[model samples]
Target: MVSRSRTRPITGVLVSLTAAGLLAGCVPGTSGAGSSNSAGKDTVVTDPAAMGKVTLNVLDTFSGGTDNAWMTSVVNAFEKKYPNITINRTSMAWGDAMAALPLKLKSHNPPDIVPPNNGWQSMGTLVRGGLLLNLDNYADAYGWKKSFPQSILSEHQFSTDGKQMGTGSVFGTPVARASLIEVYYNRSLLKQIGAKVPTTYAEFDSALAKAKSAGITPITLGNADQNGVTQPLFSLTDAFGAQSKISDFIYSKGDTGIAQTGFPKAVSTFKQWSDKGYLTKDYAGLASADAAQSFVNGKGLFHFDYSGSLPLKAGQSKGFGSFVLPRDDGGKPVTTASAAANLSISSKTKHADAAAAFLNFAAGEQAAELAVEHGTMPLLHANVKATGGDPLFADDVAIAQSISTNGTAVPFLDWATPTLYQTINTTMQSMLAGKSTEKAVVTAAGKDATAYAKTLGN
Candidate 1:
């Protein structure tokens, strides 16, 4: 989630798997007659070393920051442990990876390991097309079901036919970090405005109003490229609605609508904040990274963003702290969150065993330790030690734990449809600019999701 300024926007163009010929053949270990390890019954590899000198071609989006360092550590650790598998990693920016992966999966030779963005465009398309191998067997073999939280694991699952998501077979495992959309507040600014850190929606609103009355920017937002608004907007939505309703709308489950969730109210709240001068005046033209930097430099009371976008390292920025946006009832926190882009295996890869081994290794204690050391949230959060000296990272881990255990974490709304990204982004910008209504945005999202659901026969 580090800002890669040059990355392209996601077009969300879903290509048909059969039309593109992406399913070249039966997935390894998935098809055969009467073999215990065949027909996908038992894929537990007792010894991956038996494969002998296999190399995994990997594509990932952890190209910068502590995330990249975590990736490097995992690969080196896996190589040292196995000593027979060589990992050839290709890392790119998030947007670049999202745009390139669909095309790459369609190639004759895709990477043995691929980073698939969650939702319909990449994960769904590849799963439906038979480009990615199901990881349920590997999960079982490695005890992943017991090690990883079901809340995190559920995001990577989809039906065999790919029409449904958030259920069915596991397709991938999160590599390094968990991402949560939360509020990063400037403690100094809050104190200066005579407002305390908020623990509920009412308190947060009071702080925002106090900051505005004190002539301080209550929030610093940058949506120039449409990437910055989602955190706050979705966090508010998560706050105002049940996670089940939000997830239903996001995954095209049942007849739930975006309007049925708190999305419309969240949008209206965002618009009200804009109208009240609680946000940066030039948010429409500012980039997300710049906005985060401005908050780190002490210009705003709060800056909402994903955990991975923290502009400064833990403890590097003085008088800065983060909190999951609280619910109105003063209950446990909830937010839009999931593991970072998950790593999936290509079904066409000849080295399925080795690739699956690498994934299992990445989800282990060693990898979790490395992830925490590099300031990223570990997938095995329950076992990993809290960061030694960095309060910021410790807070991050605590927030992630709190959400995972005590509250609900919903999926990002963009996952609702291939085109929902553009639809929401444009509509949000227009709403903030006073050119569109919240009802229009909600209605458009519902219609878009319903139309896409029909295509999937949902």
Candidate 2:
């Protein structure tokens, strides 16, 4: 995801550090629903009246930006209607939220709802540990399968031991659709240089060289957060190779592992750009500063990031334009996309029906409109119009539509394994430090991947 530098440092620390602090709390025990008579097991309450005066605890990482307001409104409305049901809200920095989630769920009391970022990374762990409720029966009964798009539905559903874990289980609901790795260019800069936008790898390289000749940083990449740094590399990898190859590397799906194919090529391309000075020298230490600011401030020629940054750029600067990252051969541009922020229910929640109703409303048309009004692109239905200050939002919507309709997009790599995201972030930081080789990074990644896969019994 892309955004201005306003994200608090505390949030970043929380996301990165919470994992270690919370892992110890995950022990098997009966939830709060258990009764005094049922000494060892949780009480099963199927009837709505049986679960009275419930308070649904919601934990989310949307501390800043439009999403924060949007979610607040939704929760407030849900509470107003169900007067007896209260929503206890807890907001944290994204990093902290991600880190603290697993530990919190393992505690004696866990939130009924969690808005995990688009991926299976943290959610996968919960599913594996049986912390999340299976929403399949509820989803089927409520006709959610018909209401949600296939891509969105597929993300929540997973298979374990050849049995589907979360897909039909209704464990989660998507909040928005996320776009990863689009190319944002400063139109004024391109016009000043009299350069045409590049549509192929060779042309892209030439464009970068031209920008450098004009004394402008060709690309604005902030790697201070490892995920920020890796996004551009992942985008470039998709541009240079086939989508299937990228997927194999990300998922570690084949017999030879992800390294034997285009994985090395992707690394080599990143190294080449770094060696040639296409990326800034201080990129490794750069945090998630506003990518649009770098380009709008004339510090860089182009910025690569999610569609979420569109409004920030339009509001903050003028003469900005964006495109789907061009393909290697210039045939078509492909991107990575997924259900943006999904809502999931805890397996231990007593008011399962009420919780499901709230999520259904959250994912429905009304909530989608709220997302569009807040400058977020909606994944459910494309008919809703954007209402933010960003004029370039239409272009972003078009690019997203093109990719969704004609291109091959996949989920983010970090989504596959529980620890792969942290490992990748650490490895990328090491590479940027000049202390790690591409081969070494890949090897370390493979070790981590193997260990994680074993947890899944793969």
Best by lDDT: 1
lDDT of 1 by residue, 110-202 (tens): 899998877776677677666678777888888777666666777788887667888878888866467767788887788887877798899
lDDT of all predictions: 0.75, 0.62
My TM-score estimates for the predictions, one after another, are 0.90, 0.79
Q: Pick the candidate with the highest TM-score.
A: 1
Model 1 ranges off by over 4 Å: 1-9, 12-41, 46-51, 313-315, 404-407
Tens digit of per-residue lDDT, candidate 2, span 305-419: 7666643433553467677667777767656666557788776665677677777777766776666666666666656666645656666666555544454565565555456
Give the C-alpha lDDT of model 1. Answer: 0.75
By summed lDDT, the worst window of 10 consecutive residues in model 2 runs over 32-41
